[model samples]
Target: MTFGGTVLPEWKQRDTRPGAHPLRQSGHGQRFGGPCVKGLWRRAVVVGLALTVAACGRGGVDAKRIAAADGAEWLTYGRTYDEQRFSPLAQVNKDTVGKLGVAWWAEFDTDRGQEATPLVADGVLYTTTAWSKVYAFDARTGKQLWKYDPKVPGEAGFNACCDVVNRGVALWKGRLYVGTIDGRLIALDARTGAVAWDVQTTDRTKPYTITGAPRVVKGKVLIGNGGAEYGVRGYVSAYDADSGKLAWRFYTTPNPKGAPDGAASDRVFRDKASATWSDGVWKESGGGGTVWDAITYDPKLDLVFIGVGNGAPWNHKLRSGGKGDNLFLSSIVALRPETGEYVWHYQTTPGESWDYTATQHIMLADLNIGGVERRVVMQAPKNGFFYVLDARTGALISADKYVPVDWAERIDLSTGRPVEAPSARYRDGGISQQASSPLGGHNWQPMAFSPREGLVYVPAMRNRGFYADALGFKFIPGAWNTGLTRAQAGPNTPSPKPATPPLATGELIAWDPVARKARWTLALPAAWTSGVLATEGGLVFHAAGNAFTAYDANDGKALWSYDAGANVIAPATTYAIDGEQYVALMVGVGGAPMGGDQPRRPGRLLVFKLGGTVKPPPYPAAVAMPPLDLAAATPSKGDADRGAALFGQFCGACHRIGGLLPVLPRSPAILDGEGFKAIVLDGALKANGMAPFRRYFDEAGAEDIRAFLLWQAKQPAPAPKPGGASHG
Candidate 1:
């Protein structure tokens, strides 16, 4: 069995840390001495953003509008700058929720993932779909006003580590801004859908893709990208809202050259961050700390909180020689929005290895703990820990496991560090972590906070990430370099089966952030689930499988349910137009995690209201897969075995049978070597997002992969993998 990092040649490590604690029992969690925090030393007053807005008119999205969390419109990504995602509107209360019905619907052309949260302003509803297309609708009648397409090159689809999905768009001073999946940030006239300005956010040559929604703060548009797993460095950028000029940039990882980048983050890297790393492929990969999603702004404290993602070539030793804390990877960092200056940072997973991104949703709140009022920033990260930090000082107020955590015993509050389990590093031998996997317990999906219920609603899951590394690990420039061998991901056992982390499952957790524990839990039925929406109506809205359900905020009782008739992975939003309140969400088959071969439904925006009586049209019939050739030569067992291994490495990511791209098992392109070479090794389908794999494998290897799929196609589909459980 290959221990992921330690088994590599030319590897050496030392435990310079003091609190390397032992592992804990399987599913339960224990807390250490978590100290109560004092007020922040520096309490900056709100500036730049005046608390003024015309909610009914075109006031545009400002701090005042976002912070108000008004009922008329969803002005920003999280409804408010605090990112609480809690709607103060209560028209559809528990008593009235039974009358909620679909008012109207709008459909799109693409079948890619639907994750964007719609924004409503001036009686117009604005949202985005897959491929960075933007749309506007009559908030009251669902009339399509205008739609704008960035026309992202189809081949740019290959650059996305996930599906080519756009979370949503941002509105600033009569202009709507969207960051394309191809890395272009463009601003458009909100009324006419005309282009105002467009700027390239990243070097188009690299594998960077923007999946997060842009946040406008103090006349600057803040945006981030995702591509860490594909070997790109991570950073958050700010642009002048009116001119599309570069405002500032804060790089999460240190510069590759070990010299000043002449950027805003250069000073911090030289003083503290640069030393935490040792020479390795990370320097080349920039060590991956992308602010892929979840950027929250606090006008009171004048800080922008950005959640940072995992490292490149994810195995710690493989990335950084198992060196220092790997400053900023899997960490929560607070920055000055105007200049992108670093204020303070809290590392969640030091020396992050399991793709445990601190880049999940971060919501800000004020809580009374032991009668002491403290302003806190909270997150339920992939590592399965619920962290509550003093928002201003970055001090840990308290931390506890909201889910089963086997990686570390608990967080030592005094040191602001986890008492990580000793064997977790796998330095001495191979081991499996029951709960913490690359698909974190809590992924990038946004969580909702209920000020009324005093609980944080989280979509939590337990996914077993196989940790054994490949035999002769090498970093590929634009590929998933997490160190797991293709054989490990296959159905066959690469190592002995692991225990404690049971089969994959998911639940909706109502956590008490102040008390640092789960208040209540609701077991969900789908392998895939949507982000949550909590409202003052004493109700919480969420989607599981195709059934969207509403639950009582105080208790976990199911209040009402609706049939969505398609998979929905985006969070729900609430708004009021012309005295009528509406709840809406985006629905379409998304990501491979919904298990393979989902129904083919067109992407759609669904709006609901009390007493509304409209039904979305049924989906078109699914196309059947063609049968395989009966006259083809039967492959020798050796040929098929080699094909399975190669397929696991090169093809399994998107081409699983009955999966996201369900045209693989009986693929016509693989019927002959000539066709296989063109489609697999050449750029025949590159426009369709299937980039030629010639960089990683040649024609012979592609033929072997073809043989493997033919073999899988001849039989019933294998049991669905747990990978789709939750990566949001």
Candidate 2:
């Protein structure tokens, strides 16, 4: 069962080894020197860069006038660059943000999973963790100034279909750039984290991981890869921010011997659309369109937007080996941050079979709406709506349902389509359901937008999930639920759940893009997936589960909170160094499939500010766990009648072996025995993509799978008997 790239060689935490190599440039891609040849090769320009320097577009700067509006120093990744996580640094507004505090903190000795976003400048902070490593800290006393790793390739965490985590870093000139869950693109040296150039942005043998964050602009850097669920092919490159090279790519799907924006009127189905997916399911379904997270960057429209993801075995009738509309997948696109071309696209789920993904957060602004300043580009997309568009012609100036959608009962706006909801698709034994499921009522986080509280906060999550087929599934190169086939366990299973008068939790809302509505909406004890920043006095900042808060962006009330004990993962940034204003976040409670009960492994790295005398710093230690072979470990069970006939011949559409099946198991990190012996002997937990039991167990069939998961967590939990019921 350890399927994806297998590597639990005792949780191999760190062994990087590649340091000081620098000094290249000679015969750059040579032709005169033999061994390489591009356009007859060429190389000569040396050194050059410095002019009080400033070139690289894409919302690149303007932290409200170059890091000033209250400055505490949070360089990028939505802090600015039109990513608009907003932050005009209001020295702890909402009336002294309830005396804010905790001034320091920075514990990430690495249990692997932080999904970064720290990057302060001058006072020094930078982020990036879980498999991509990268640190740097010291932003006002958190200390520990250097870390870097890059070791990626313990089979690239089985090309992470999700969660080997990383999302942070990117500075420019003095250097930093990141991208490398094994797709490479390094750089570093922003005053000594070392390794100046690494390259190789894609082709992790075609698996690609790069968990987001890497924008740099002007002199290039960009990035964008994450196997839209282990089925690759979803470009966006652009390098050379100073010797990394490669320069341009684009390609969000379309090319079958044509694509410069293919068209039949909006890229009309583009060349046989993955030839309807059956035979060899496109090299084991390796074409899902993975641009991982938001990439923003408008520098007054030098473009570079990007979002696109989803379009793999999320059953678009089995990867379009049928249906159609597969065009630039869950799209948004835009491009041209210096030749990555493509320039435009909107799509947002066109032949998309429910994993609906516009990769989440994007922001960018200008607004004034009916008064007409225009330029916008908001986004909430996990298909539950909240759009806004018109960022210079992607059109659709409005879209609603900030949450709980029963699969689009309204979104027609003269013809943007959506009417949807016939129980939301997937036939056969009937089980459909749908309403922002696919763990998305907003996926990937980051969603602010304040210009002194005009609104738009959102952290969202109304939750719902159901759908099937993988008929014979297939594609298994580098695995992680690859290609498919794994849905058994059926029996008395009932579990339909989530419908308690529709308040299934998670919020932060806000809205008001020039009076489009909802300016307030609190709720939150769990389910936020991080994001929210706003500032300039009224306040907003955010973080849940392990606490850290601040609100009142004009009445959601509650200004200031603390705790930082767990959960609250990522997105919460502010800045303003000299004149004071620091906020910073990126805390991870677990590799999120959802985070509520907290504590999974060490994981911490908070950073607040607003006086009462700072403090924090001194936690970083818990990263030293490797010695459990216990001479060939032990924990087995091998046959609940052959694991219920191999989970009903192959895992019944998205897991549910619970009181013995009905399904819809939202990754409780695979319910235990050390997460089932690291999902059967660890290929780094199938390279972070899960679903790996080393191709069906074998160390005594994973000790009879720890006695069938201690006879399935000691059974129980399945009572609630009532009308719509069957009591498995």
Candidate 3:
């Protein structure tokens, strides 16, 4: 039977003898005594074969199957429960990598960042884009099979501290799980991309958001949230994979009233965590500690390791009266997967300030250390420390500084605590410059570990920050509660004089966990680049600026490179189909700190293999921003200050003074009040991904923002320092 305007060739039959008798024809149908019977039999056979193929295509990816994945498929965020992000397939190794070229490319509709790590399983490729849009494609070809958009409200953009981004999705039995930026966890049919179950994972009334990928452990989907800077308590929730029912929750911080939350973390909070806080202010500030990223499950140990975030107000004096270890903040906490009960924890940054979050990357491996094989959990947290801990007990095995940092002298191995520098806190109200800025030596980029080489490939950063207490700090609801003035915590400004030599750049570091030192370093053109991918083929791949390059796994030597026409902030994943291996990555810009200065471009999924020859579409040239005309407005400092605050609330997430987005002080549109209104209030630039903020700001507010931009334009440009700092 033909359906949907397409002919079903298999269903058609040819008759002999001029159709003398349908049953008498010399065909298989004749043996059945009628053409109708034959047709039904043939159809049944076809349907049976189709069902068999479909079943084979959707392999069951349970915990047991994932544990035995063997890198032939990209089954999870890190390809396995260990989150090693390493592949055993090595067909396209260092020798053949030089001939790698694009095999197929699929462009996305959105121009925002593409931070997803595509999951490849059963010959299907699944990934997510900005705004939590999920898609599935044929692994061998670039044919799109299905797509799912959660239809998140546009107004929800305000809740995101960074650009609206969804890290990726999780695959369970026959469902694909994703955490939306608006704080919803959704499960989709693996074949059809239809919503199977949907659950709101966070309080909608608060500013909580979810930009990380969901992880399924022991039949439950685990998800955490962001927005510690907006005054909400942080927690990680688990939902039943089949019914979407809340299984349990573990709050990362203590309650304000000292009452039990009646959740899995109640006892731990009441007994261990609550006392670590200085009651009054922490109760009010939610104490930060958002478990926004880096969740890994150890199937053997049955423990879930959650990497916690920084403090709420950042400044200790403001968040916790300048005291307290802040129990879970900036720490790696181990929890029971089934019950969400706290097991043990290791604090990476005690009394965490300076946005030194432990939520960078986590991997598990068995390593030979000091003449013994150790089961360890490895992490390169933001505070410039690389730590190895016993995954089962959460005991610190070794800690070392992987990057140059001045905040603390070193981590004391005896006590597993940092020996803080006296001047690191900036408590005396003077501007204190700190190495390894709040952006972190390493951020959300996933690192790769190669058991063959015994080295972890890290995307490392080098930057500095200036922290100072704000004048008259007061909590502002629905806004950044950093407790520091904008000038102090704002974008990085060049130092007038050198306290130390500048050190801001990006590099791919091959780190030896045993030796605690870098083996070799490959300098990147820019910081905040994409994650790393290690293959058994002796190749390591990474994306930076607009180029995706592959290097020798043992030594940092460039083997192949491709200019993808846009910045790639996502890691690359490799999978095999029909006995051939392929590497895939999403290309675009506009995440947290990078790509704001670069022109917004449509996102694309690019795949590569040896001798493949498909070219990516050319990206549009960046538009030259018009210069600001300060002669247009003469507003008072009070109006300018108000405008600055409004700008922070609205524009600061994407646009900084010298970052990727168009700098307001240099934009010629700000020279004309009407033009500025057209862009901001009337959506003149909506086509370019700048959504109209008419509902949030009126003409008066727009004018105030314009006045502030004009005031900023009159000031001298800060001198460029050797090192650069970008937002996370």
Candidate 4:
């Protein structure tokens, strides 16, 4: 049985965990023992942690300093509160970029998705890797200072909708905050990786995940969760940074009981959002609408923006009885940061049925439209539309398709709704449609905006969707709850091969949010790509497949390129130390590792500078797997067919044939039936993320799944590329 690796039991840990909160450097210019260090000496020493006596104001990366958008420090997740992801540093501009080469690189121990955006402050670069691990590095030389692993129970891996990846961490007064995949929000002392406060944020019994990074607004740390696909209610929460106490929470969906949840969102959910959802599978599946990603804070408006995810059962008819527009699902909502009070919202996909989640990316900007300067909040959600909305009131300023969207012909500006095609819902019948499917016109990859050029760089995609409802669907707790037929479910399925293959292509679009259109587009041979990074130096950086490249932000010109040695799903970030600008990217593969031969590469931090030369360590060669013998017990007539259906429903989400998880055909367990039954049917390997399937299947079912793998092993296919999974 599996024993270690982030899977520790802490179900009873519901209260705030107290720890040391020593004074830290804010870097805002106060003396060594000034007002910043006046009176916190006793508190610092009490917790057995050494305290620093440096410049401290409110003692953290406060609102004013972040608003300055300094060139040296990348304090916040998106560099600043606006989430523009545009670095102001220009030492390595277009004219000097040709000399750009690798300065330093750091490889992570975990070999899953590297989605974290490294946060740099005062010359220290901090980032998180898979399995909710955090690390601190020297920005200039890439020296590792410390690493902390949450040790989230490996069984919690069953709860993750995507791979076990973390977006990064949030920094506060001398502390770094991270949310674990198993629903714990923890704060670590920045100077020394020691626990300050730890709080369990969700019902441990339910399938809830916190893959997204935490954000700090005012004195509270804000975080949301994933697992809408599994059965759980969604909410964005706030905790006191110093004490780790619960401040408030805002549920994205409503309580079916129609009673107040005693939450900050009680009033709005009761009067507005509660009416839209009906009471069937919706109630059973917790009526999904998790705020998995895209939480932005607007200091000017004093509002926190949250992008909400898809409904629990993605099929609208199945979730809400095919009736009212699910008010908050697939929406961008505004909330008062202090009290979690609801302000206003703009739903991107009304009654969303096609997994068109609005929780892609939300960026705040000031745009000039029709001779007026407007403070706008923009998003290019999963449904293929680019939206520009009034930041203060959530008014629809503009909405238009940025990709080929057949689900909706156009957005009705007058009504602020999509003029959806009738056949798009599959209400007439289960049909295949050519559009941007759950692969999304865009997924969770972070986009970047250049205020200097008035453009938002979007890593856009196009795909086809085949939607069909699962007949006689039963609500399974903490399992794949999308109510989709097995054929259309799992990573193995996206769209069938069409006679024409335009949808398979991806692109980088220089999108003009004000014009509601693409200013320029760069088509890519591969549809799966990485997040974008824009710079004031007239450049945009992103990784397509394994090649990381930089392009001119104004006209989309490829200026520099490097072989990242693997797929990079995370966005690139730029920061400067000692007057030199550096671009750092986290590289790995996860989500849905696009099918094909993949090269095995380590999760890495690759940094670049204008005139520095450093080479990353060579990747270990991919090992070839011996062909499966399957000489033990044989399969029955229909065992392979039954196993094919069963694997897609259960195993396919993680154990893709050529992805991150174990490639079962070559796995030793395939040759050991008794061992396979122990691991699959019994709870033998439950600690290693192989959760017991006895709850859903029997020994015979386990054998059937094995039969299906043996059948696959017997088939002829491409030599295992043995590498990347193009995922989150």
lDDT of all the models against the reference?
Answer: 0.77, 0.61, 0.78, 0.78
**Candidate 1 wrongly placed segments (more than 4 Å):** 1-56, 427-431, 488-502, 591-596, 620-646, 657-659, 712-716, 721-728
lDDT tens digits, residue span 1-728, model 1: 12333341111111123421111111112211111111211111111011112322455656555554445578888888888888766657777788889999999988788899999877789999999999999888999999999989887877776688889999878899999989999999999999999999998888899989999999999999988877888999999999999999999999888778777899899899888998777977778888889899988899999999999877787788778888889999999999999999999999887889998999999999889988899999989999999999999998899878888999999998888887677432364554667767887778999888899999887666656655566777776676655432223434434554445677899999877788899887754578899987788998876778899988979989988877778899988754456898998755343443345567889999887899887775444444668457344232556677776655665565433564466556655667767877888888878778888876677776776666666667556555343433
User: Which lDDT value does model 2 have at 534?
Assistant: 75
lDDT, candidate 3, at 247: 98
Candidate 4, 17: how far from true, in Å?
55
TM-score of each: 0.88, 0.30, 0.87, 0.88
User: Model 4 over residues 1-728: C-alpha lDDT tens digits?
Assistant: 11223331222111122421112111122122323334544233211211122233236666765765344568899998999998765556676678788999988877778889999876689999988999999888899999999899988888887888899999987899999999999999997899998999999989899999999999999999989888888899999999999999999888866778899989997787888877668888888899888999999999999999999888777788878888799999999999999999999998988889988888999888999999999999989989999999999989988888988889999889999887787543364464876778898999999878889999988766667666677778877777777551222434233344334567899999877778999987567788999876688998888789889998999998888777778898987654357899998883235442344566999889877689887665445455566675455333777787788677876776645577676566776677888888886887667778898888888888887777776666644331233335
lDDT, candidate 3, 272-366, per-residue tens: 88888884456676888898888999987889999999888888887888778988999899999999999999999988879999988889999
**Error of model 3, residue 98, in angstroms:** 1.4
Q: Over 4 Å off in model 4, which ranges?
A: 1-58, 488-503, 590-599, 622-626, 630-638, 658-660, 665-668, 683-687, 715-726
Scored against the true structure, residue 110 in model 1 reaches a CA lDDT of: 84
| Candidate 2 lDDT, 1-728, residue by residue in tens | 12135442211111122321011111122111211112321221101111011122122333232322123345678766777776544446665566667677767765445767887766678888777888887776778788888877565565565546788878865777888777887888877889978988776566677888888777788888877665566777777787887766766665433334332222333344444334324335555777778888776776777888787656665565546666577878776677665656777667677678897788888888877798888888888788888876687777788887886687777666678777676644335657666667777877777766678888777766655554555555444442233333323333333343222457888988667667788878776446677766667777766676787777888766876655665777765443345677777645223211122455777676666355554333334223233224344435544554344333332233221111322233334446555665664354434445566545555544344433453455343222110100
- Comparing 1 and 2 on lDDT, the stronger one: 1
